[model samples]
Target: MPHTGHHLRAVFRRPDFRRLLSARLTFQGADGVFQAGLTGTILFNPDRQTSAMAIALGFAVLLLPYSLIGPFAGVLLDRWSRRNVLIIANIVRAAVVPAVAAMIWVGIAAEAFLPLVLIVVGGTRLVSAAVSAALPHVVDEKELVTANSFISTAGGLAYAVGIAAAMGLRPLFGASDHGYAIIALMSVLGYVGTALVIRKFTPNELGPDDVPDSGGVSVARLAWHELRTGAQHLAARKNAAGALLVVVGMRVFFGAALIAVVLLYRNYFTADGFFRTHETGLGQIMFASAAGNLIAAGITPAATRLFGTRQWLGMLLPLAAAAQLGLGILFTMPGLIAASFLVAIASQGARLVAETTLQTECADEYRGRVFSVFDTLFNACLVLGLVAGAAFLPETGKSYAALIVISVGYGLLAAGYLWLSRGSTLPVMPAKPKTEPAQALTQLR
Candidate 1:
């Protein structure tokens, strides 16, 4: 196999791949800015009282409704032009951010605040699903793992950069609602940029390629049939299905850990030395995780090549479990930060493999629906984890019980994934068709 650098270069040589990646980085960065600003206002603002239940409720309000819509969105992706989806979704998000910012500005009721934010959040999810489904169109099958790593890692880094930029600008903007509102407004630039970049592609450039006929069916019934068809297709691909299950389990664990960390920073830890404030401490932890993601992006392609996709994923799940037990149990700032770094590496690495598996195994026509299912399950499980953590964890977020449960869950999930993946063969790149010397020479050129 060629060096990872060579694979990256080959992938980047494709024009559509670069364009799609540009759009992904832009909107995901916007997502980071929007999310960081929103969290700062809801969780860290001194004027408001935040608790575990409030946090859980906030997640449910933001995620569950959109998750319900996710499958329908998937069906639409299959029927409609995905290029239009990306363009329109970003435009809707750009329009929605100011409304959210305005709500924050006017001190809108939580009831009003959450629903409006949900629109923006839901749009972001839609764009993400579309992007994942569209990726296979731009890159060759042989380069899928490397291509996934590049996009995932780069997009994650873009998100982290957006967060860091928001945090840095927070002091300048002030930690008040007005400041967060301004920060929220900053995301509009990213949204607009993404929309413009996606416009460069033709309508069918990123595609379902073949759309199933609706044939005189009612809209509602058609959607249901399409969704069911997508589900049945996924069910038949056991490797892809198993990868999704592992992803769901990992999201649950990560979600609970996130809630615990947020509470710890808000209520448990005190300011000292580098941890000048709770918000600062949380930012540091986020940066640490981002760093781990960066490292994973660099190493995962090689790791997967060495161990095979399923085996590497199997190794990562246990590593996450060990990180929780060995480091997270300490419950100190440094301990949590270090633990977060390792957990991030494991999480990002596993996701890279899972994404490749889905893209490789599932047919293009079903890809959109399958990914939408993936998105729905991903968010729904995260919300489940948040709610569960809130029910059991204290105000201070210290709970040996919660930590132990999460760790044990990871261990069991690892065992289950390994068993589920048994006898699944590794994906092999197709050999290039033979060509005449003149044609081959021309292609090389």
Candidate 2:
């Protein structure tokens, strides 16, 4: 077997894979910048008084549209040219973001603000679906795990870089609405960059391979039928289904933890010693999570090869539970940061496994719908978790009860996943005959 470095090099050697990855990195980085700008405007603005419920509501406003349109978007992905979808989606985002920035600049965020933001976010979700659907087309089947790990982790790091850029530039841009508006505009460059990079692919190069016949059905009705078919396909694949369920469960708990952390920084913690303002503290946590994601990219490929995908995922859930418990009990900045790191590793590792499982198990025609379902459940459940946590949490966001419940939920989820997967065959990589180092490297190339 080749080393992890060899696997990554092999994946990146493909020109199409590089192009797709470049697009992903660019758009996701833009997403980070846009998201940070919003965070500054809404959550961290000194003039604004933020609460747990308000935060929950904000999440709902941003995420629910994706849930609503995700399935329909999935159907379009399967039928339409995915490359064009990527290009058009980014163009739409480039157009909509300026509208959002204008709304922010005018300080009128009630009527059209949420709607415009929703449009931008929904477009991002579509781009994400198209990218995920297109991934298998650019890489070989055996390299899926490595390809996914690299793209996912690198994209995340790119997002972190965007956030860091926004944070650093905020002072120059001014921390006021005007500054945030400029920051929001910065994302347009990334959106445009993504479109340009993705244009390198032929119209149908990244594809559904075999498009579903609509049979004179209207798009609305065809979407409904296709969604059902996609759901059935996922349900039939027990491993993929189980992996997705685990990812959803993890997202729910992670969402609650995230909300709590935000509140802790914004309301409870104060600037003293190394601790800074809410924005700075939150930035630290975000960077910590990004660091963990980078680590997961390095570790997961080998971990899954050694332990099998299901078992590795099972192991990660408990680590997440432990991380949650550590933060809940300690309730300090250092604890929060440390917990963020550990939880990201666990969460990202599980996501890598789940994505690979879906790509491996589902046919190309169904992959788009399947990934869209994955996106919908992932975001919807995160919002659901945030809302539920808000209902129970105090203004201080220091609800030990909420944290404990989330930690326990992780444990139960892990146990359930392991039991359900007990009788199933694990997707373990088979060992290859040992070769000279040069030969192994040559094979990877």
Candidate 3:
């Protein structure tokens, strides 16, 4: 491990990793800005109902298509030039965002918010899945963990900074329509930047070429094969399965908890309360959570080393549940705001790093589809969270009891599952060579 660490450092000393890392930062920086600003943009219209609906729809737009398309995306990724897929995906997203912003700006279709948001969301997810699936092709096996860590850190920070920047820019746009337009423009710029960097990459940077099944393959047959291949790879390894299971379960648990957060926030701050009058307070809460996520990303590499990935993630499950419970308790208590935020940041940040690292450790051939499966699970949980949160929060009249029951229950179940599976055999880490900056950028271009 120490020798690998030395090689990791030595590899980065070469310019390729530096450039690849820089491109990652640029792309994710744009992502952070977009995500942070999106909620604010939706809320700018002052129709709380519409804004809330937009938020709901925005999430749906992104998650549903990602889930549905995710199964096939991996197969396509294996068959296509990862770089081309990535570049095209981002460019498509760049184009879509502007169109949506225009419709909203003209007010001709601003009211038809659901369809518009979905178009943008679905498009972005398709692109994102392609990029994620292709990531292993860009970094070395020894440095894969470090690269994954760096990416997760960049992503979380982008989430925080982007949201913060968006909030700050709120006054300039005045309306979410314009704000989203700018964000879309940023997306365009980011994608262009990414495409330029990706153009530098060569085919050698990627995993071994995938030979399509020789047997006459139908669309259904291909999807089934891809899905089963990913599953079989996972099933072959016990520790990897345990790791994957905990992470997937965490996604389901988080879906419910995040829904509770929206409910609590809307009830306590946005809907009506002493806190309701402060406009950006709700935004600040999101900012705080992202901040926590960023912090976790920073420390995750260290944490994974400190706690065995299996044991630590196993334990974090219960701790995260407890954190959610804390969030549920603190939802209405204005005085304990900082404590609530702390818990949230720690829980989410820790989990994000832990899960991503686990997925990256899986086999190279399976990595794309493995991640796709995880993406499917994550998106599925998100959809379920939206429905459950909407149903539970509004109908339950902000029932803390229900929130506690769901959050803690899932946490315990995940923790127990991990504990029992702790002794299981772990998988050998997969091998993948890092792409040169020139090669990664060029192959895709």
Candidate 4:
């Protein structure tokens, strides 16, 4: 399983990988649709009547719960059948989207939509956990990095395409509640498609490998203990723990930048109030940022090879810091756009590499718990960043103080990253699972 020119091609042609890819693409594609549809109702809609605080509040509420208890809840993924989790989660999403869509058709969207979106986001997060846990099951251990790169990068591209399509599709549907309703419904195809794709997987194929002699610990008890367990696990792997911290710190800065970008485009960058509504403006910038993600996907594997994971990650933190400072001082439309792309590259590059580190460093039995911790911190940091931005951003998103504070924060983060990554390297071999037959598994029988 050493590197080969055709190895990537071989991975794709694999039947199980193909099915999983179908599930991923369809789900991610739908995520684009769901997001695009919501834009008309929330983020970018000119008619929606939003303010800087409102946008930040919306995201904060949406992601906060997952971050708080998400890891503990995510431990269920290891105990439950991953196959059923994907299958049930996707189908349930398909069944539920139309209800939200129907609510959109009424004027109650402001009240009802956020809650509905919360459900949709929950389902999406669950599916994501299942997929990440299941991935190692489908591909060879040696191929984890490249395989993940292809899957993640391609899924991101698919999501961007969905967002781009939503831009046009909403207008065709008239960019109103009714229009959003139609777009909301479009996500159903992805959910249903993914559910069907996952049906091909036998129940235990995705695995915890069935730990025996458990002393019959209740799942509820396991849940209570899992977070502590995950923390202890991380404490032991200093480099792995450091890598997770790097991602968390990066997200704090990322959140503030998001607020700045939204404020800049929505209120400030309307081509002197002549062209580009906030919706279009945000979309244009998102497309550009997404393109940076695609570019990162292509280069990260090679970059990791040359620089090594710790060194590459250490370098990315400072680069993102530099970009934020440039955007803060320059504060021009072009500068804002450039900052968006640079951050996207740095963020995606860091995440992809960090994920590879996690999968390789942590034992398979604890991966779900580990990822849950990862997801919880990942999301919690986003809210923290947004909250920070809201505190500093003016109505127009043009506060120099805000920019300076963010830049200073990024400088601190970069310093911490340097301290952590000083002499470490990504381990070549995966950590061994502690238990025999490792953990839990489920069978239809």
| Alpha-carbon runs more than 4 Å astray in model 1 | 427-445
The per-residue C-alpha lDDT of model 3 at residue 55 equals 50
Off by over 4 Å in 3: 1-11, 35-38, 51-58, 108-116, 123-128, 213-220, 270-279, 332-361, 395-397, 425-445
Q: Kindly indicate the candidate among 1 and 2 with the higher TM-score.
A: 2
Residue-by-residue lDDT tens digits, candidate 1, 1-445 = 3677878888999999999999999998999899989989888877667789888989999999989989988888888899999999889989989998998877765567888899888998898889989998898866766788789888988988888899999989999888999999999999999999999999998997998788999867888888898898767766667767887888888888889998998888888777644777888988889888888878777876676667777788899999999999998988898999999898888777667666766678887887888889999999999998888889889999999999999999989878867885553122222222111110000
Q: Best to worst by TM-score, what's the order?
A: 2, 1, 4, 3
Error of 1 at 98 (Å): 1.3
Tens-digit lDDT track of model 4 for 106-179? 85746557876777887777787678877888887666667777788888888888888888786689878888
Output the better candidate (3/4) by lDDT. Answer: 4
Candidate 2: tens digits of C-alpha lDDT, residues 54-74: 889888988987898899999
- Each model's TM-score? 0.94, 0.95, 0.81, 0.91
User: Candidate 1 — which pairs collide?
Assistant: none
Sort by lDDT, top down from the best: 1, 2, 4, 3
Q: How far off is residue 63 in model 3, in Å?
A: 1.1
Candidate 3's displacement at residue 43, Å, is 3.9
Count of backbone collisions within predicted model 3: 24
lDDT of each: 0.83, 0.83, 0.56, 0.74
Kindly report which residue pairs in candidate 4 clash with one another.
210-439, 211-439
